[model samples]
Target: MAMSRQDSRLRYRAVARLHAENIDQGFLPILGQDFLALLYQAIDESPDSALILAEEEGQVCGFIAGALDLKPVYRGLLRRWPALFLSLAPSLLIPTRLWRIIEIVRYSRKAGKGEAVESLPAAELLSVAVAPSCRGRGHAEALYIELARFFIERDQEAFKIVVGSELEHAHRFYRRMGAEPRAEIAVHGGTPSTAYVQQCADIHVSR
Candidate 1:
């Protein structure tokens, strides 16, 4: 059955809420639900990006967001900058939030210059989250497999996942998915993160 426009909107909104509630370490979550919904919608709409979700009984149980080339995703967001800026206005007023945003921009510049870490693929796994109630299920793994298929279909050989060092559970999850830590880096100064690289060739998508 084809999904209606209203169902698609609800899924995006659910994705935003799940991200904020589950992805606590990221600066994007601090920007709040409205911004996240818009961002995910953009990712779904962008040719360079992909957003995949696991739904059970019409509820979003998990979701993964990624891009083969971030430039297009960035362009998509920038094209809608006015609404995104307005959505982020309240968070921008907070000094800590503003500083994080600046840190993110600086990190992006460094990454562009190859100063952030060793050479890595242009394709990236931006964010993945599964709701707590749905944790024991295979939702996370299924979403990841689907994302790997997404990259593979795009001819992306490899992809990277940047996760907070403090997130041991996340590290374990990635490890289980056959990703290996490639480098230690910080998106925000002093806060450590591990960049994990996953080779798409190794993924077996039973289709």
Candidate 2:
């Protein structure tokens, strides 16, 4: 179903709840309260980040988190204020920058020769998930469509995403969306993940 921009608040809450619940699971067992607070802060402070949720009959069934690239800001903060990184050190070790390093390495190796890393477009599709009961109902696709529209409305030229090898279904879904495999990078403590890129100019959205 098509979603209205006015529903952003509801979507954000649902997405935040899903993210908190998932983190509570095996994804990042070490994420403590402080880390979660920091994460929320990051999202709240960034104009580029967004939380999107899918609902049916007034009940939230799935959600997706997306953001325009804001890494430069964080990186600058880390460099200028090393103490800040140190303050969040414990949390970083578990599910922040340090943890992401592992994934990057794994993906790099899988990317093989001739593949080069490119800067992601300003827009990115970060994370997406559906409730167990809502599986196979196209909620994920619907959410993606919403994200694309969001970017398009902002005049973004492209969008990108990273999908782990373990998420076979996601890989297929993205392929169907006309995303091309761009690079492979190792995810620390896990297998390689493939990076995919899709140009909005090439995407044909049907009404």
Candidate 3:
């Protein structure tokens, strides 16, 4: 659908609502309960994070979560003053904060083993979902385009996405977005996950 100023307010509201609902329902399934709190903090504190939602008649049709890595900043701070994150660790270990810690540790170990470089400043195209009734209406593409613009504005180096091995449709969609397969990480289940990367410079250079 062609989004216009006339639909902007309604669309914004739908985006906010869909964002909250998706965090509570959609993300929980994929990230697991162990990682939800970290996901929440990542979205809340990262200035580059955003939610792009498509709406029709005040109803949300689709949404995607975009997040940038704060690792660069964290690493710098730790290097300059080693005690900061260490001091903050006590509070982060409280029952409510432990989940994010667990998630970071788990992902850090995975990153160490995987070929995907964890040191670069990267953005994550975390999740995307379209309402069942709104499938095949181009809303998904619109949401992604909006997110691409947002990421470009931030001068991000690259955007990373992970897709389940069996989801051929999603794989094709990411390929259409110019994301190339970069790595594969084996999950607990027999199926491995595919990681895709699209560099901002590459996109601009192509255009």
Candidate 4:
């Protein structure tokens, strides 16, 4: 149990680091201990959340975050950690990209231009990223394989990823992984984006 707990933290830290520098981080930097605390709540406190990390030479190179049921997990986070979020309020004043935390949440809540969230009881791929230096090494695929297995074992059955349209590389990656566009949505500042869903059958990852 202790080892499992430590591994979770390690994975969280790795993903957090990658997210901070993600191409879309411009939308929501989420920097600092406050945001890290929020991540802990999301990934650790949320029973339906899953994270998988890829390592190289004992250091994290990439990771992916997913949720079996995001609405409940988010609701629980807000209810159980009001104080933590409240404490993070003042950080909004910082010039970093933290301010978008509010905007991003609002932007994502609006149903995409052509898709509805009710189409399926599918797991969500919250985020996935790999260090620039580690790209093209198959780390991303490994992480997704782990995530696929995680979802399958839990009976989540299907997974979806909401991402920006400008991220052409990532979109292509998901397409190659067998994701199909389900809807288009508006993001922070009314920018266009899309949501893609992949069934467990569509993706094949070696066990």
Candidate 5:
């Protein structure tokens, strides 16, 4: 089945399965039940972002979500729904998730260092997840291709994807997809993450 717009209800279910299936290990894990709810809300409200789903018989097999520009995404979500995200703030402050809070602050401080539009053309590959049963069926790759097309339509030429160092499978898959390590950042859980950049041309290489 082709990737299509995700309705609110489907988005909710996908987020739960994303965490429950451990597919979120490639990105950040949902910290709590409300985390997914809040995330779907954010993605729903953002104008420059998208959450696309690939379904079969009403089941969400794979999905990808990303923002063309991160600025508006944060502004629309965190700023408008500050209270909602703030409610989750306490969770990250817990001893087990303390590092997550720190890492978020760290990244916030670095936002000012983003390259100017004239200096670079890029987008963030926020997340891509496929159910375990959906693996090896080319669903992940298809979702990526659709994502790349979205960026290409916007005339973007590069994409940055951050992957946890511990997810070797994801790292290998990304490399095979033509993404190369560009830099590293310390993320939640104090984990070191490698940021891979895939030029537009590379993203379509396998197509």
Candidate 6:
């Protein structure tokens, strides 16, 4: 049991580093690796969320995090608020960073209230990324498929993903994976993000 926990922690650290280095457009990476690691740990432990990884010879090459219901994921994080707060405290000292956090929270709250043009599934793909060296490989798609399997096994029919409008490569990737753009909104004040929905009803998962 101790070894399993240790291995999980190590995986979290590796993916956190990968996320910070590759998913540069996000607000969470700015909080540093410790915060990101803790966040991934929470996702792994949360019943409503999942953290899936693609490893190469035991090294984490890519990862994806998602929740069947984000409210429960938020509750899981709140349960670990003390540790999360400790990890986030230093960033709070930066006014801009603090505001960005507030913006994220407000955005989440608004989305929770059904502010979208059409209602989206409660299940959502929170984050996905692959290391720069592994980009041409299919690790990203594999991780995504695994997460879709996670949701499908839980009876979730569809899942949503939000990508920054300027990330053309990411947009293309999701579209290729059969996710259709459903709406656009800004999580931060001026940064527009497009939300895409992937229906799992027709997706065939071989693994």
Q: In candidate 2, what are the lDDT values of residues 97-154, reduced to their tens digit?
A: 5656455434434432333445656577867778878877878777887878778888
Q: Give model 4's TM-score versus the native structure.
A: 0.76
In model 2, the runs with Cα more than 4 Å from the true position are 1-17, 20-29, 32-41, 72-115, 187-191, 201-207
Better-scoring candidate (lDDT), 2 or 5: 5
Q: What TM-score would each prediction reach against the true structure?
A: 0.89, 0.63, 0.59, 0.76, 0.77, 0.90
Candidate 3's residue-wise lDDT over 1-207, tens digit each?
Answer: 866655654554454444455444322333333233234334534565776666787676888777775454334334534344553455455754466445544663455344554543367786787876787787777777777777889887678887778778888888876888878765433347887887755542222
| Clash pairs, model 4 backbone | 112-185, 113-184
Relative to the true structure, candidate 3 reaches a TM of: 0.59
Each model's lDDT comes to: 0.83, 0.62, 0.60, 0.70, 0.67, 0.83
Positional deviation of residue 56's Cα in model 5 after best superposition, in angstroms: 1.1
In candidate 1, how many Å is residue 84 off? 1.6
lDDT of 5 by residue, 1-207 (tens): 643546665566676567556664532344554555566556646766666677767777778877666556556556646655664676756765666655665664454265421232347777777887877778888888887877788877877787888889889878988888877765555578887888867863353
The 10-residue segment of model 2 with minimum total lDDT is: 107-116
Better of 4 and 5 by lDDT: 4
Look at candidate 3 and tell me the lDDT of residue 121: 34
Candidate 1, superposed: residue stretches over 4 Å from native = 204-207
**lDDT of prediction 5:** 0.67
Report lDDT (Cα) of residue 104, candidate 4. 56
Q: Among all windows of ten consecutive residues in candidate 1, which has the lowest summed lDDT?
A: 109-118
